[model samples]
Structures are given as C-alpha cells and as structure tokens.
Target: MVLEKVVEILRNYKDEQDLEVTMASTFEELELDSLDTVELVMEIEEAFDTSIEMDGELQTIGDVVTLIEKAIA
Candidate 1:
C-alpha cells in the first residue's frame, strides 16, 4: 500500500532524522513543520496518484494510512 511505502520511506531514515512519526503522535509531535508537511503530502500524492486535502485532520501517520486506504478502496 502507498501508506506502507510512506512508512517505509520514513523508517529508512537515520537515527538523527526527524522521521520517526507514529500513529499515536501528531504531526507537530513528530516535529514536522509546515514545509515538512507539505513535502510529505506531495510525496503521498505522487506515490498514490491521489490528492489529499490539508484539512488539518490528518494529524498523525495512522490518519494518513487510513485515508490512503479509503482512497485506494
């Protein structure tokens, strides 16, 4: 799934990287600033061929995974 691929990308990061986002954490909790969020959305769009609205509700990695599943389904 695209969400799994996204998680894979994040998991491949270095220990010093700010990519340890998880389901229980908010984007802010992950230290993902505005730019990081934008980049992440873009990557997801390109990977899945779907556009995600920035409705301020996708606050965690799990939320994104659920959204992607809905889109794919």
Candidate 2:
C-alpha cells in the first residue's frame, strides 16, 4: 500500500527522462531538492495518515518504504 502511494506521488513529478523510479533510487537521483522532499513527505503523511519525521538516514526510496511499513505496523 505504502509503495503504491509513494509511486503515485512520484508519478506526479515524472518527466520523459524520469519515467522510471525504483526502490533503490535516491532523492538526489530523482533531482528532488529539500523543498520537494518536504512536499513529498507531506503527501506521504496525508496518504498514510501518519507523521514522518525526516532524518538524515532516509536516503533512498527503500528507506521511505521501510519507514512507512514500520509506522503502519
């Protein structure tokens, strides 16, 4: 569920060159700035009905999936 929502959110920013975003993809690889990250977190929080505190440890899409899984668990 979390992965689907995250992919949906990511799709909103997809361009011709960025059609593929995988779990191993990092925010940097996506060219997401700090502001974009903040917005992404907000969207994720709203979708999952949970608050996610941003930490330095979250680097890849897999990290976000793990975080949401842990939160929802």
Q: Which model scores highest in TM-score? A: 2
Error of 2 at 44 (Å): 0.6
Task: For each candidate, give its TM-score against the true structure.
Answer: 0.71, 0.85
Candidates' RMSD to native = 3.0, 2.1
lDDT of 2: 0.81
Q: Write the per-residue lDDT of candidate 1 for residues 11-42, one digit (tens) a residue.
A: 54323445655567666876777778777777
lDDT of 2 by residue, 21-54 (tens): 7889898998888788878878888889988769
Would you give me the overall lDDT of model 1?
0.70
Candidate 1 regions off by >4 Å? 11-21
Show the colliding residue pairs in model 1: none
